[model samples]
Target: MQTSTETETFGFIVNDISRLIRAEMDRRTTEAGLGLTTGEGRVLLNVRRFGPTRQNLLAERLGVEAMTLSGLVDRLESKGYVERQPDPADRRAKLVTLTDEGEAVVCGMEPITAAIRADAARGIDPDDWQLLLAVLKVARNNLMAARAEAQSAESAAA
Candidate 1:
């Protein structure tokens, strides 16, 4: 068995990589003049990905609090990047959608994102990159399952 000092742990390596990627994306987005905070950009991307999702659901997916997401949405909406509409299925809730302007911004972001991804994958074999993605997906799913189990247990206890 390898001692902690002898080898980097999986969590530490994964987290460091995540942090570096976020920092690089933040820098590139700023340099690109996207006029968006990292959180705001993430919100826009996720909104596009999920397609007119309810605000609460979007917040949950992003692992942020609803109120925090609301503020981000407000800023994006003010910038004409996103619009919040009454949720047809739930009158009390609002659904977030990317505006035409938002779509254009997302398009503008594409090159920056691609460049960052390429930089991160530099020197890694294509097969190894694919394997890394697969491993990360499995790890994410495992964590999600564990979270669900913990939540269920808490609900049962309560």
Candidate 2:
């Protein structure tokens, strides 16, 4: 019932790929016995990648609600995988950092993610892979800019 053109649109393809990748990550992480839900794994990896980020900023980056992130952080903290510390520059804001155990879990995740990347890139040439990454980066930046512009306009109109 679906036409090739409809399925080939940028939004359709990108969304489909994103869903598939998330599902694969969930399955792989479970099989690896990381004892994390996909959302928790994502939080850990993002924290490892960004390092000691403020909770609000981390929520924005992760495209999650602050309350949702708070719940996840609570669980991770209870598991001895992460800790929340008051931000030095903002007394009221909290920063999230991975505990040693979280770092260990992230280290364990690296190979699994690398394998997924390898599998996804299997048929692509090195140059094409680099090009694909570059293109996606540009697309992401453009979308972020658009969102910022809309937010600015909304604030100005208020």
Q: How far out, in Å, is residue 4 in model 2?
A: 12
Model 1 local distance difference test score: 0.91
Please list the Cα RMSD from the true structure of every candidate, rounded to 1 decimal place.
2.8, 2.5
Across residues 61-112, which tens digit of lDDT does each residue of candidate 1 receive?
8889999999999999999999999998889989999999999999998898
TM-score of each predicted structure versus truth: 0.90, 0.93
lDDT for residue 6 in candidate 1, whole number 0-100: 34
Which number leads on lDDT?
Answer: 2
Whole-model lDDT values for every prediction: 0.91, 0.93
Q: Which pairs clash in model 2?
A: none
Which 10 residues in a row give candidate 1 its minimum summed lDDT?
A: 2-11
